[model samples]
Target: MSGASPRGPSVADRGTWPSPGAEAAAHSRRLAGVIGSALDAAGGWLSFADYMQLALYAPGLGYYAAGADKFGEAGDFVTAPEISPLFAEVCAAQIDGVLRALGGGEVLELGPGTGRFAAGALAEFRARGTPITGYSLLEVSPDLRSRQQALLAASDEPPVDARRIPPRWLDSLPAPFRGVLFANEVIDALPCERFVMRGGAAWRLGVGRAAGAARDDMPRFEWRARPADGACTGDAGFVAAMAQRLDDLAAAGVTLPEGCCGEFHPQLAAWVASLADVLEAGLLLFVDYGLPRTQLLHPDRAMGSLRCHHRHHAHGDPFLWPGLQDITAWVDFTALAEAGVAAGLEVAGFTTQAGFLLGGGIEARLAARLAPPTAGEAALGEVARAQLAQGVRRLLLPGEMGEAVKVMALAKDCGAPTAFALQDLRRGL
Candidate 1:
């Protein structure tokens, strides 16, 4: 199922991918036309970040903005929560610690995918007698919101009161907010500023029509390199920020060779800063697939970590289906840590997902499952045990989510929790 393309190796293409239906295809075509118009208005070139924004968030035609099943076998990709409920249980332990440290507070989830994690966490908190004032979701996709609502409503009784924060209210988050903030697999989706190192200079990677491409036909957008002109692309601030990050990486003794291409997320710093600004006290925890700057920018990864996922088909062609595919870039943990520090937050801990979850109590959960049932309780069945084992393997195996997924916790006045401290990998970073 894997193959190499002009870009690089394809990793997500697996299983029987269901083709997009007529409606979805038409939607993609419409989105492509919109992007084409924008490209033409921009003098036939648009920065990759702009293109990504339009592709994933452009009003109603974009991938996320459109109503599409995006989180299961039938969807483009699967997230950890969808994989197993155990993920939320382990996360609950860490969240409980943060809430405990702050006495008691609400839970702010950046993107509650299908509300699975929220449900699991709420159940755990309720079972443990932990008090959660509220569960606030900042989800942008109305389609996803409906799905989340349906899933949560089907539950007999949700432990905490849940509410959605309208996008317009994001700028006015509870002032002096004190709570636990969660962002699982969120930062990776933030638009990345792709840059190309060619001709002994770094040029911004933009999207534009192929040279002499027929306007009458479907506009074929391709990678177009030009001088790093941020103002021309309406991303002046991002240009300066990207330059600073690259300079910082070079100062740390890591540099990419000429003709190499990669991505840097300037929005990450700003996003972290914005969150830190309103937080009077709390912990910001994140889980995503990524690597440290040194490793991420190593000579081995010349093409960077940008990738696309469509119907579980992991590929590198972001230009193929336009708004129909999910585009992402691997997060730079070192960059994240630096940003947290700059924002006056402590880089409490960083480690692999396996380590974090195990420290937070995955083994104990497995042990409880493996142990014999108490009197009048049914023992764990063979099929259930096998399923649990499979989930564990997928979560902890090196070739699976284990090594690739990273856990990082940033804190305000609250110190690092013991759960994360157990396997802190900040030294490696």
Candidate 2:
């Protein structure tokens, strides 16, 4: 938010769901005609991944790059962080454990969406009496950054040491800082190159057009890149590096707009390296929905976690609505752990949300919410009780966000002991 002010960033420029059934079919016809001819010149058929990237990230025509309502009741899926205040409250509790253990430090957040998570988390942190210098954010999108700014109007100053770092410069981790570097649903949003495993071959996905479609689209994808001799071992390190591009971008000063099409972060390793270097003694708490490399390339997931979110319907095709929907892939937590270790950070712990919450003394908190009041008033207490119950049901039930997501904490050598309580949960895993 410093330096030059954000450029004419006005989110009101777009607001509305897409209705492309009729128009899309018509547009598809025209695009297929032009695009098909181009593809026919090269060869035939486009891989699903290629087709997906162009549909989702292609400059002016990709899904997320388009102008669609991405979050809330109108968008695809709602993250737990987006649901209610409870998620932040729980996070506040968890962070308190970290700060208390570390004595004191800062809280830096990456890709804080619309400041909702920050608002909730900061509020809870304040309520818990945790001493945080301020909140720093590394945002890539001007629109989202502005939105986050407006949302946190009260704590107008930099949340901590506010800075606009691009996504590709992960090495710029603020050094000598003792605190928590927290990311909520951030890793999954990192760009990733997708590979499809077919007949034991791992081929990268890219876009090229086909000449025979009724409406020839632009350069669609054709899996022309030859695969490695054997099946791809799922290069965890390489994938991590790629995903870290956003972290690197934080410092690189890349100007990303609403409609620019580009590849997903392909530089995760560098990002991790930066964090490891600057984290003198602190925790890297990653809360996201990701899997280890094994599960990522499992036969069932051979196609990779590549999927497009259009009107909330996830599909492999990104062309459903250009500059409208979200293009995201599943993150590999196992890969993240590997990257952390490679960067000299010890993998302190990993567990499902249920495990983390339960391990972090959530049971006691939940019990307190339900404990029968001794001298409380009457109706007011009952209403508060109902709300508390609602939070528990939404956050703890396995069928909900509870068991669906996972939390991982990586730490430097000096900070491992403080994370021990929660680390115990992932011991047997």
Which candidate has the highest TM-score of all?
1
lDDT by residue (tens digit), candidate 1, 1-429: 112111112464534445677777778888999999998898878889889989988988888888887777767777778776788888987788788888987778887868888778877777776656767777777777777777776765564533322112131355567878898988888888888777755678889887776443556778987877555754676567656657766887877788788887768888999888867898889999898877876668888789988766776778876778888888899889988999999999899988887888888897787788999988888988887877766677677777788999889998776777668789867
Q: Write the per-residue lDDT of candidate 2 for residues 322-361, one digit (tens) a residue.
A: 4444656666666677778899888887777766766666
Full-model lDDT for every candidate: 0.77, 0.56
Give per-model CA RMSD: 4.0, 11.1
The segments of candidate 2 whose C-alpha lies over 4 angstroms from its true place after superposition are: 1-68, 154-176, 213-225, 228-266, 363-391, 414-429
The estimated TM-scores of all candidates read: 0.90, 0.69
Instruction: Score candidate 2 by lDDT.
Output: 0.56
Clashes of each: 4, 68
